[model samples]
Target chain A: MSSEVAVSKTGTRLRSPRHMLADSATLGPFLTLLVLFVLFSLFIPKFLSWRSVSGIVNAATPIGIVTIGVTLLMICGEFDLSVGSLVALGGYVFAMLLLAGAPPALAALLAVALPALFGLLNGLLLVWTGIPSFIVTLGTRSIYRGIVWLFSGGTLIQMLERPAVLALFNGRLDVLNELLPKGANFRTSLIWFLLAVLVFQYLLTRTTFGNHIFAAGGNAQAAAAQGVNVSRVKVISFAFSGALAGLTGILLFSQFRTVRVTTGAGMELSAIAAAVVGGTALNGGVGSIWGALIGVLLISMLRTGVILMDIPFIPADNFEAVVGATIVGAAVLNTWLGQGRAKR
Target chain B: MGRTQDHSEPLVRMEAIVKRFGTITALDGVDFEVEYQQVHALLGDNGAGKSTLIKILTGVYPPTEGRIYFEGRHVRFSSPRDARALGIETVYQDLALVDTMSITRNFFLGREIVRRLGPIPWLDMRAMNERTRSALRDIGIEIRAPHEKVGSLSGGERQSIAIGRAVHFGAKLLILDEPTSALSVAETRKVLSYIENAKARGLSVIFITHNVRHVHMVADAYTILRHGRKVGTYYRGELSERDIADLITGERER
Candidate 1:
């Protein structure tokens, strides 16, 4: 009779909602982002406009590109903090070369290759020394940033007047007007952004490389036991993340019409916040490009909301503290609630 | 199950298997044999060199001195893949799966089905998922969707999935390292059934555990280990479950 009763209770527990989501802590970030969106929509009036929405997406695109790449590396249980430095390096290298009579396409290509080389360096140093990625990237961050300063002399290389570069970056292709109501023009960057996202999605979902990435991150020893090339996955992931950040550097330079040594300063934190906000775990092995886009959108929303609200307590530039606090707060809340659910 | 050897054929042979971790000898001159088409129970205590011997078999750590024979041919496995290529697979306690990935993806992870396109290649998701679904169903694990993430599966279900992966990959000798150690009674029974299914398929399995109950239920023959040495090898019908337990917990002699 006791055995029968125990069996019934076990079955009940198995069928319960709590038991369903206890699988892994991957969904914590996704749930938190949803809750945050609901909360802000209820409270913030300026958050609902189409202009506001598009603006948030525009802001997210550059960071979305970087976050996607970093999440791929993070999925492999590695980090590349030198990405911010790589961004600065990428922009400066491209801008200087373009000024020295390089073609616009060539300038753009170097921007990607230079940082990819830096990524390769980070990879070789990491494997050879067997140091944690945090320490390795810290050292490389300083090296890359110093090169950015030396190469560009700590001055903004104003590319606003460069007609060739401007055409690619500043050009607008109005394909969205056909889909939406009148006067809705599509920026070329959005197209580029979507294409990149789609390509990464395909690689992650439909290619063998995606499998290798997850295997390497989930358990390197087990992956190696399964005949996976673990080292190559780490190298490629980190290098790819850095290279993607480089693309953003060029994009950022175009948007701001300038490139300086500190062009990518503090971008890593924001990228990470967006990635975490989107549904990526700090421990890695689970993330979505959809979640990341949403995460970046959330951050952009928070920024815009704070600005439009004219929150007088904090001044501009120092507002990053508030933003940082909010993101960390979200992460903490997400982790706590997710753990509680898993326990249940 | 005992020795079902019709011919003088031994599938795997270990001669003087020696392993050391710094000053401590984990395995010392242990000789073990696994015949084809039999379920072998590796009985041992926490420090009875069970893990070391299994590691050597799966090619995680090289034997300090001695040799291994696979199908009567001398084989030196430098990696786990090397061991698997010659037919060896291990299902550890952790399951070693990415919880977020789908069942099909996890099953065909390292050895994915792919279609070549000129110089490029793409993973064939449909074929892989179909195989994974059938593999699970064959073991009495009727998972509703092969697209379901492995983390979503219950403990027993996860074991079923893991076992299915091993069977699909054609591992001749599957080394299960304490499979039912942390499982519920029901889950343990499910795992035992899966082991029987694998045995029915004529796959030689090394069911390593200290649980004599586990061995008594599914194992054909038992190889007992104590203090880095083989105590004895006994046929299943010759000894009782309690006696096998005594052997594992050091309560009796060989």
Candidate 2:
């Protein structure tokens, strides 16, 4: 019996240096982010300054939180295009409740829950009708935005009241501000973003639900055959994505004290871009929340770099073109790395 | 039906089984029995209701008419999960494994070993990995690590893992659908030996295949089905490979 155990060739092949590098999902994105950070620091005079670094993180907070949810859903092999509208819907709900003399805690809960419900609807539609999530979320995206438009009468809803509860969401970090030099502006939203990343990354790596998410996305039929309840997993993933988007809206409104129909316009594409750039596969079943965070940081850094460079031909307003190119390049790099592992 | 007092009854017995798909009668009054600690080969051509019979047994579809007896008691399964709950596990050709996941992860996929921290249940990675390694070792397979991805494994190794997982999870009656249909000669030999290993460990396996050679390798008893009806069931010494082939193709009457 001992002689019958033929040693696998993969045991030797996996020890190779290339395979080691390819095996870690976060390494590629992390390296790219480091390279970009160095390049930006060298070319731009103030790029390495505390103010510039903090600004990039600040800009990444809302989209970064949204991308975490998108990454989870993407790993489960689905998309939520309605997330941008859900963000706006979340902001509207929160602001409306606050104006109606509701407690800030209750308002925040309802805001998050409402968007999560919409996300649940997206999952149910996909599961029941057997439609692709891309299409289902796309249709709901416009419908959700329209609902926001009608609710707010296509106008801005601004609040001047700065309740203590609002500070928990996006208040400036007073201690850090006092310790650091002037212009080093940090906010509570960054803490919220980091917390979201930690919790979700843990969810994807350590939990049973996370295992099922990978299995569900990797092979739905195979997962179902093992009694994994794939539909329920996917629906839960969709709801998570929606809840995150709503949370992003709360972060936005808390900082700016403003809500409008166009609050989260075009955010879905950015969130997807960040997730993809972080090495999340479009096909599902393979992704990392950590990679996605690096992706968000990389894109935000690019936006800042492009603006600071002040190149005449590639102006700040045209930063999206650079981000788009980064997305395609990162996707190609991810595929090449993935193939290297599979080829073994 | 009352439970049989006799301890020597067959592990599974299906009497006068019939299945209909709308206007089509896929199976017609087929009777099959698998004894304890035996490799029972179910040989048939494609569309000979091999799948339908197994599906009925595994609870994929309810039988239109028939009674199933397991452990000498009349039983019916509403879903594949119910069958699994009764220690009846079917390993289809595809193996129902997630390729991108680790061997240990696949080994304990739906039935993961977990420890609770506060209210959250976290995967007990150490326990699962150790158990997977030892379980495969018990089945004469020594894997270097349990964290190796299933995609990186050979076909024989993958089959070994699937069979090992089923056996480790308490599968008393294992139903393997074409366990060697898509393997090289060496890989097929490995899978056949795994089936033997399963039988040696006190498991009753219903090995379904169209290949006579594979049946000759591991089967203790063979049942022949042609055109949704059983030609006959025979002991290993009663029929040669040629006789079994001819019976399958209906060129020779039973």
Q: Give each prediction's DockQ, rounded to 2 decimals.
A: 0.35, 0.58
lDDT for A165 (candidate 1): 71
Encode model 1's per-residue lDDT on B41-123: one tens digit a residue. 99988899998898898888899999998877899988777898977888877746666577888888888999877866788
**Top-lDDT structure, candidate number:** 2
User: How large is the interface RMSD of candidate 1?
Assistant: 4.6
Per-residue CA lDDT of model 2 for A200-242, tens digit only, reads 9888989889999999988887788778999999999999999
Taking chain A by itself, what TM-score does each prediction score?
0.85, 0.95
Off by over 4 Å in 2: A1-14, B1-6
lDDT of 2 by residue, B105-214 (tens): 88998988889999888889999999999998898887877987776677778888989999998898999999898899998998898899888888999999999998
Error of 1 at A273 (Å): 0.6
**lDDT (Cα, tens digit) per residue for candidate 1, span A289-312:** 666667777777777777766777
* Interface RMSD list for the candidates: 4.6, 2.1
Minimum summed lDDT over a 10-residue window in model 1 chain B is located at B1-10
lDDT minimum window of 10 residues, candidate 2 chain B: B1-10
